[model samples]
Target: MRTAAYVLVRHELRLLASLAMWLARRTHGAGGGRVFGYARGQGAMMFGFAFVCLVETLTMSVLLRDYPTVHQMVFVLDVYTIVFVVGVHAACVVRPHVLDPDVLRIRRAVHVDLRLPVDRIAAVRRELRTTHEHADGELDIPVGAQTTVTVELAEPVAHFGFFGRRRDIHLVRFHADDADSLVQALGQALAGAVTQARSAPSPRPDLPA
Candidate 1:
């Protein structure tokens, strides 16, 4: 009876662990088993800015309490609400880049969702320069980034930008805290993808043809 009880407890523990993992994945928006990479410095900066905004808002609220006219009250409320919204947006900016087996997904706070296929990548290189001068057909997503990784595509991709403007992009540049490591990992994944495609057998042709 003790042995049977032990096994039952083990099974319940596994079920509970699985439930917790599922909930975590759902909360993180990692539904497809994608790995995440973060811009640590940029995230820190955003959080710091949010904290400053919070302090300023509180100070303003206290200062404006004496002049409680309808107009002044409305202005104060608007300022507080705007700052609160900005802080929330800043918090969301910490969302990491999702790296899938065959794609790199970048999601910005209600601004852009970029999905780049692994097979289409021609090269992944690190740019050490502090400021990058973008070429005419390049799509750049710097987002207050410090380190940079430039991804060259084999062919031009149609990227829809803000305001629904579509443009053909031959290269993409983005920032990451560990740009070198990211480039190395991405290169290895792309190489493996290429090898797999080459090793895949082609469809059989018709005998009569």
Candidate 2:
């Protein structure tokens, strides 16, 4: 019970923070990094769903007008539902995938956020996959009904779930609005990371680029 409450509180906090970021037209962590957005595919769907909720709220407000106590309670719940739905979309908008010089950060709303070291990435490609199969060591973060990018890592990376569950992932598939550009940028970053790793002396570490 306590764990569930904590997760709920954490999720609400993330949504509120996301709402602020969305209102400010700012991304969460894209400073000094390339931002790749996956939210475009789901933007229409999310708003459409919110519209449906708005309609239902209106309908319920009229039907429950006879019972003052129940009407007030239902009205509050309906408004909260609308806020929650919109906040989820806002979270997706603000928390985009980020690619630094040495790490590639992939995210989906307030849930998945996995950072893979550039050196550990074996291959990255622009493969549009609408269907995915769940397998051990594979993590798929699909946007809408499809994924536009596929990444295979040379080694496994740890991924933590919303409930604090942990798993080791060797393959990751996700969506990006401009997948070709993301793939190209990742290829260049990987090459640079590899070159730097090879030239660095074992006893002395190279400075952060």
True-vs-predicted CA distance for residue 21, candidate 2, Å = 1.4
- Residue 92 CA error for candidate 1 (Å)? 4.8
What would the per-residue lDDT of candidate 1 be over residues 87-153, giving only the tens digit for each residue?
A: 3344333345667788876655434567788888899899854566767778777656443778899
Which residue runs of candidate 1 sit more than 4 Å off their true CA positions? 1-27, 70-94, 145-147
Clashing residue pair totals per candidate (backbone < 3 A)? 0, 0
Candidate 2: stretches off by over 4 Å: 201-209
Tens digits of per-residue lDDT, candidate 2, 40-124, equal: 8898998898899899889988999999899899989988888888898899989999999989999999988899999899999
Residue pairs in clash, model 1: none
- Where is the poorest 10-residue window by lDDT in model 2? 1-10
For candidate 1, the per-residue lDDT at 158 reads 79
